[model samples]
Target: MTSPVPSVDLRLVDLLRHDLTAADFTVPGVEAVVGPTAAAALHREQDVPARRAVAAVLRAVADPAAVLTALWVLGEDVTRRQVDAALPGLGADGAVALGLVEASGQGADDAVRAAVDLRPYAAQDAVGEVTWWLASDLSELQTGRRLAADHVLGAGGASLTLAQVTMRDPRGRVLDLGTGCGIQALHAARHAGSVVATDISRRALAFAAFNAALDQPDAVTALDLREGSMLEPVTGERFDLVVSNPPFVITPRTGAAGGGASGLPDYEYRDGGRAGDDLVRDLVVGLGEVLEPGGVAQLLGNWEHRRGEPWTERVGSWLDAAGLDGWVVQREVLDPAEYAETWLRDGGSTSDRDPAVWADAYGAWLDDFASRDVEAVGFGIVTLRRPDPAAAPAGRVTLRRLEEHTGSVRQPLGAHLAAVLAAHDRLQGLDDDALAAQRLVVAPDVTEERYLTPGAADPNVVLLRQGDGLGRAVHASTSLAALTGASDGELTVGQITGAIAALFDVSATDLAAELLPAVRGLVTDGFLLLPQ
Candidate 1:
């Protein structure tokens, strides 16, 4: 008879780091192996309770003090006493109480140790300045499962996206919702006067606090770590800037990502939930109330689009409903089936054996969208500026499309805002009389060239280059070319045309009709720059 394949819960392997890191063992290759030795090493590395037990297991094979020194080098936080506390022979109830293993029946430490032994290779590099761990087995599917409370999330495109688009010059206050390891908050605090970071899980919050402390100790002091669902604990509080990389996974959870039996809500850091991307919708809408007037809110989000509906229109409508001036830019779009499979792997679904199950999951995703008439999906960075309703006309919302994506961050974005506001001020102040009298301002690089065919007394055509707005060069009548050439700060269109009439020995009246249009064209097309 054929043997039944064993089903191993992938989430246990995911949480090994949290348990091991807690114990202070420097697991070098948790992502490299499978089975008990890896798990035992992970348990020894992560759990304070597993320290002595893990040490006992290792001492049976390796040097005891050398292992202790390696553990200290990995994390000074772990102590020898803490390792001793995890030693076995303490009682069946005690091992379970100490959290060394899953307390299912009696002594499960052996199983726990076996899992730890499966952890990645733990070793110091040559200089010993930094410790490294491999994640060869940390697949996209594994990442989708519940991440540990102290899960050291691997770097990915999403994290880089958030880093590129987040506001760098924060004012009064800032908040990082779902602050994973406090990366968002850390970046925000460099500019924000005050920062508040919150996560649904305490362990996640603690990790955020630790990372913040390690990087920016003083700013860490200013960070108020709160445990609650998105913005719940901070009701009525507003900020100059609010940033988030919420759990946006569109998957169901099998308990928590961290190992062991913990009741924490599996707030998948990247999941948008199964609610048709409503998680992002609610977050944007919530910021409308939470943002101070003239303040800006930035987010990285994904949206589902129904057939026959323009995605831009749908996203723009959301901003309009929120009563905010938003600049929504859609960066990319994806098809239905491909999107489903990508996320299935992310959610850690071990459906490799069941091709039918994979098809079913894809079918479910399609049906969910089809029922709602969603045809395509979009993901992008959204920037919104809450309007001060009482402010001037220049402060209205604007939406623009970016030409391309540049991986390098645009730091000091304040200059761009200043330029935008300056343009707004200049355009809003234009009166009809000023518009009628607007003069063309020419640049130094502009010149007029006259061309004539074979031996003619008068030039047949006049060419204007660098004088027109942008980089356009055009052929014009001599009268038009003369009008443009005279626009150097020395004279206005009226004066320049009058001089041209005298030079060409033509009537001023005729010149006015011919050159006036060309001068107006130059100013309108921005061939010439006006005084600022």
Candidate 2:
């Protein structure tokens, strides 16, 4: 039987916190006990090495950290004495009461096993580095079975990815839609005056509440936990910022191939129970209703790339429908087979373990794709901002930029995003003449590279590369290169372009017209900065 969802017993949770802190069952502490080899192996989802590593530590020393790692993290059975030692404040009985563990027998020799997956998570964002204890349903490694439909996910790669990219600017109110374990809400609480965390799963809300109270009590007090699907709970409200890592995984509809009698595996943590990417589409288009003017929403999503239709057009249409200023950075693309294998393995359906089940699910996935004429799947980070009504354009030029940047980008991109948005707004207010009069400076992170033919004097290519933000590389024309090289906050763009025009024997008007667009692109992308 599936274990009961954990209760939010503040008293017991406080005691558990005290014990956890005392035992130093933190990220660093666990790494120390498991050693680097086991730690690295565990990160790859291999537990044997971590188990052996922790076991060796326990044999040599009766350490609380080792005991906790072996019992909770490694999912190994520990004696009553070990459990008592690890959680002295919250004894074995207290742990069982909180639904964190279960005892098999009354004797000390009897083994006690963890009922949930609890681990320490540490991360650094705009707010700074923070450590928190996160609780969720145990994984296949712990339960030795496939996951339940409504599994509350812990801090996985996607969670951290969304967290790192979230804009941490201060806001009056923030919303965390589809908050799995409340990680995004926790991050939002750092900067948001008030945070509302909502989820479709009641069980997920319980975990979110528990984690919030345990990790951020002050922030949790301001958190409003509501249970509902999508935006139903906060229908009429508006927020300054909204962040979500929604159940955007595209799953097949019922009776479709691989869908089985149950249709798709309705994992509340991933699948939105909607047909073929509709969940993502609906969220993107409907977000405008809940966003206050000038508000911003950041999300991670996957969209289907249908045959003969570009991914940009499909996503761009959503942006146009919403009428919000939007930018999408496609990070990766996977074909139908690769996509099926990934999600299948993610849900613990592997060919080696169950070839027949895998085959059926695989066929269903392919059939679903065939029905939709989907050639591939595209995944990316999407940033949307509601244009401020006061500064709204007469023609309302929506920023519909769809670019691919799969390469490495600077972490904690919140500040960069804010800068880009600010720059865009500033540029919007300036006409060509006004823009030319403004002084400009090259950003510190930008570098220029020139490549020349082996024995030739004149360079054949000039590239301006950004070392931060999206890490963009732009090809620069001779005149534009000269303009950027001289941009030191000391010369107006008009004067620089005039000098370049004279040097190249070109009309100043023609040269400015040619380079103005490139200049605007550089500034918006963080390669150039408008003088303060």
Which candidate number would show the highest TM-score if scored against the true structure? 2
**Which 10-residue window of candidate 2 scores lowest in summed lDDT?**
255-264
Q: Model 1 RMSD to the real structure?
A: 13.5
Estimate, for each residue in 97-152, the C-alpha lDDT of model 1 and write its tens digit. Answer: 32222323333322221101112222211112223222211222222233333343
Off-target runs (Cα >4 Å) in candidate 1 are 1-155, 249-267, 350-356, 389-532
Assess every candidate by TM-score: 0.55, 0.96
Q: Per-residue CA lDDT of candidate 2, range 396-515, in tens?
A: 745779998889988777788889988988888888999899899999999999999999998899999999887889999988999999999999999999999999898999999999
lDDT for each candidate structure: 0.53, 0.88
Judge candidate 1 against the unseen true structure and give its global Cα lDDT, from 0 to 1. Answer: 0.53
lDDT of model number 2: 0.88
Clashes of 2: 2
